[model samples]
Target chain A: MRLADLGERSGVPLATVKYYLREGLLPPGRRVNATQAEYDESHLRRLRLVRAMIQVGRIPVATVREVLAHVDDDSLGLTVRLGAALWALPHPAGEAPGAPAEAAGPSREAADDPHRAAADLLVDELLARLGWSAARELGALSPAHRALVATLATLHRLGYPLDADDLLPYARTMEQAAAHDLDRMEQLPTPREQTEYAVASAALFEPVLLNLRRLAQCEESNRRYGL
Target chain B: MRLADLGERSGVPLATVKYYLREGLLPPGRRVNATQAEYDESHLRRLRLVRAMIQVGRIPVATVREVLAHVDDDSLGLTVRLGAALWALPHPAGEAPGAPAEAAGPSREAADDPHRAAADLLVDELLARLGWSAARELGALSPAHRALVATLATLHRLGYPLDADDLLPYARTMEQAAAHDLDRMEQLPTPREQTEYAVASAALFEPVLLNLRRLAQCEESNRRYGL
Candidate 1:
């Protein structure tokens, strides 16, 4: 299809599509002549994925690129690719990616960052208590791990005083739901397909998880406070 | 306590505390004399909440003001206060707060936003099917409602084809979790305490929900694909 048709069909503006191509977010279309290019169905699908990641997921372009790299890396196992996809999402505030590992650097300034050490220890204890094997693949400093630690710190900072044990039930609940997510993805025939599903789920479905929790909170509140 | 002591105890910098005061996110300290003000324990607590909301919750200054206002409003019921807190959190892209109701504006241009109308209808159908009374208090145009609709719409746009029926299990699981949250909060002594807990829970603990889900997903992947 022509670039115009690709934009029309994908519902993305031609200029934005061109910009994505320039940014390496979209694969280059086949050069048709000196002035034009042709996009295929795969391009349309990729464009849609890009839009989903950027527009709906609110992911930065750099993070989106990293996630796409993981999706494209055939050497990685399904679970490993899924792990990378998980880490590639936006980090919570006060937590940069690999924050704990960064604190291990030799710079004099690194030693002053106690929050990273505290968070790492907290998560280690929680994982040990939960008897979960995920830490083996996630590494101690993966963004997801740091995010959990940062959350606890925030709660404590607000005087909420959440114990690591308090997170167990919620973890178990998510594990049950995630089992369903993986069960469906595992049925796909190819690693590429599995990675695609993993990426899409990680990027696009976060709002589903969050909004569902909010809605449920509302229901619980209504029952408690209402006559 | 003095303002300096409040800043020290809260761990928020004096400059930032002053900024919150100027922004009306924190109440002014009682005047002690010329060129000085006396802040008490309440100021210290409010400063902590402000830091949590801004740093951990990533809430913008304006929304923080609105949320704090709701917390301080004695005339509002607990349910209303919670609903407002829910609305004040970051919303998913394509889901502006009160989006469903925006289409009802008198301007002829308003009715063309089909995504909003479609999302509203989808949520309405889902709420009816779930037999949840939350919609009454949440209002059809509430932020949580818009977020849910926007998520479903994003899925559709990305070619995932999620029906409102498919959201049932997620809603049920979240209800189970939220019951725990509300059960804990209801034990607090007064309406003010309840509202504070609700706001803090809504604003700060989102990372707990998101990161737990991510960690659990990793475990699910390990179980399915690991040796």
Candidate 2:
């Protein structure tokens, strides 16, 4: 099919399709002539995936390019590609050393560096692993991706000596909170209600994070003042 | 009082302090002389708040600037400012229309757009309100935040129609699923174990979403083949 037909089928505008092509997000269509190019089912699939990453994931084009490169690699699994995209979202704390190795496990050693170079690498690796894991499972969900990235970036900028190990505690906290949150969601007693609950729960996740932080802040304040 | 002293007191490096000032994230200290600026408790408080917004809230500088501006406005409650900052993280789902009339109310007549623009706005507002209430109660737990945002973004991209009337069912579902997930988490004994469970759960949320999608896909496939 021609570009117009492909656009019509995808329900995306022609201009947006052209922009995707120029951005190298879409692969070149079969050239029928100097001015015309044809698309196929693969193009449709790729376009959908691209839209998913951009609209849902809210990923920047440069990062999307990197993710696409990883995705297109035959050697890498879907999980790994997803991880790369997640990792590309933002810098995390304790990222200067052998973070990835530590995140992946003992197979990789933490090398000593006077400048904490090993620590930086470790942080980077750990984030990559976490990103990959999150992406594989949660590619359909973009807000979570943005929230995590934003949180990580904030922590990084704050000079917090964070690593995957430190993050483990926070991650655990979030998981428990989510579990509790999800439990409350299941009481609705209908399939439609269940789906609605999923959507609502997902929407509420950020504010829940904020409220939890307030709780943590209260706890911190109590500890600080010996209240 | 000097930059070095302030750095030591805040545990922030002098260079980083300079960077913060340059980024407009921090105000310059009082100029004691041509070569030195004196810092004080207010600076310390501001710095900490900045750090929290950056790290915990994951707000960007531009958004942070807006937040700071709003925070300085005494008329706005701190909770309101905080909520606004959190809301700002997710890119606008297009311009928000008028405030929603009420939760669980009937859909309003959408204006010119046949796609029910008013209804969509009403639903988004309702969801936002639901999120705000949850945040006030639950605290900002990262996993929940990510889950909710991702789900909303996905639905938005999928062109799901929503309205205020849709909220009650959605919330009811979340309350159920969250409860179910939490009950499983509590089976693990000890706070530390609970913490570990939380981390694992964070890792697991993605898988849950993926599995749900997989189930849906499988059901669709089975129906197609009469399996």
Clashes of 1: 0
Per-residue lDDT for A1-227 in model 1, tens only?
A: 99899899887788989999999988888998999888998788788888887876678899888888887788888888878766777755432233233323222332464544455566777777777776644654566665676656545545567666666767777777787777767777878778777777777776777777788788877787872
lDDT of every predicted structure (CA atoms)? 0.71, 0.44
Best model per DockQ: 1
lDDT of 2 by residue, B48-132 (tens): 5555555344456786666455444455433343333333332222211231221112223334344444434543465466544
Fnat for each model: 0.60, 0.01
**TM-score value, chain A, candidate 2:** 0.43
lDDT over C-alpha atoms for residue B210 of model 2: 25
Docking quality class, candidate 2:
incorrect
TM-score of every candidate: 0.85, 0.44
* DockQ each: 0.52, 0.08
Model 1 lDDT tens row, B1-227? 88888888876778988888998988888898998998887777777777877776667899888888888888888888777766666765432232233322322332565544555566777788888876644554566665666666556655666666556767777878898788778788877677777777777676777777778788777877882
Cα lDDT of model 2 by residue, A1-227, tens digit: 99998888776778988999999989999999999988997687567566655654455788777756655655544334333333444222212131232223221232432223433443345435444343333332433333333333333433333456544433433444444434553465643333333432333233323322332222222222232
- Model 1 pairs whose backbones collide: none
Top model number, TM-score: 1
